[model samples]
Target: MTSRAAGASLPGLTGTPLDPDQEEARRLLQEELDSGDYRVEESWLVRLWRWFTDLLPDPASFGPLPGWSTWAILGVVGAAVVAGVLFVTRDRWRAARLSPTGPAGAVLDGMRRSAADYRSAAREAMDAGRLDDAVLEAYRAIAAGAIERTLLEDRPGRTAHEVALELGPTFVDSADALRRAGDVFDAVRYGDHRASTDQARAVLELEARLAQARPELGADRHPGLVVPS
Candidate 1:
């Protein structure tokens, strides 16, 4: 009898058997569904169908937009913004582009021009016997020398003071000389005092020394790029 019962159990194993937990879960799900466990959503498809049937107008009656215009409103706004930005940045951009670039020749050319200007001014001042004007030209010359000969490059980024400071101790004596020259000129011109011939000679000699110091500061020369001095 046990052999017969084993044979029956083997046949049942060959077929799929229902799990007790799964069977219980299925029964609970069916009961919940029968009692309406889920909330029903409104049928969007039915609503859309009803709207199309009841509310949609004939396509042939539809007209184009009222203004019959293209390139309206936003185009004007975009153009105005672009124009404004260009107008604002125009001068600065031009200045930046035309500003000096690289070193050597550029710096030299600028220096040459500056030197010519100062010399012209100095000569005029000398002719007029205006000591103050002469002193200003002398200072201008020093500043020009510092930028043109001392800097490896003549780009627009550096200021006079910065160049002067970078020149180390050499600038000290030169700056003092020019500054004293200015004072001497101020005294001679405004205070009704006269700068003696010796004083004029000393000022010119100091100017020469400062010019000499400029090229010395550019000791660390670069062929085509900016160099540290």
Candidate 2:
């Protein structure tokens, strides 16, 4: 009789099963091969390019248009896309220009309302129990009142913190309060925190005190002048 090789099954035992260890190993190898974890993802720029190309009219549908014509069409579409991007981000660009040196979200966009108007609005909001709105409007009143009184220059990109620091020397007694008020304003305006009644009252009281206090503007009165902490 011919000798069979080790671990080799004879023709009569073709149905022989693998050992438990071998079966488990086979399963683990198969799983590793089938997993999607190793697949490389396409970069965003590549995806964007694919999307743009997909949006273009099929050249075949254009009835054998000249190569130059195809390029010209692509140029027009590209220009339109660029224009749309700029239009959508126009506000951010304006904000950047207005506040190149200020903190993020600190840009005081040009407000059409005067300081008195903001103060009145803040009071109304407070009475109506809109603490958040009261805080916002009261901070605006502080900024606007300073600008109106020439304590702060009415520049396009002036921020709340900048206003506080600039007016620190002028309002020596309330310097820390001004800084804290600025913090409260930023928290309500940009942070996830909501304004509480106490915070609203604090801002309102600060605004009132600032209104009553006279600013000491001297020969050094100018923009970008910050008091040292």
lDDT of 1 by residue, 122-146 (tens): 6577567765556546545655655
Worst 10 residues of 2 by lDDT: 95-104
Q: Write one digit per residue (lDDT tens) for candidate 2, span 1-229.
A: 2333444553433534333377765775576666876678899757867888898778787587776986798799788778867998998974443332423465355556888999999999999999988988998898888777667776876677888889899889999988877777776676655778988999999999988886665536655443323
lDDT of 1: 0.51
- The RMSD (Cα, Å) of candidate 1 is 22.5
In candidate 1, clashing pairs total 1
TM-score of each: 0.33, 0.50
Count of backbone clashes for each model?
1, 0
For each candidate, what is the lDDT? 0.51, 0.76
Candidate 2 shows a clash count of: 0
Lowest summed lDDT across 10 adjacent residues in model 1 is found at 102-111
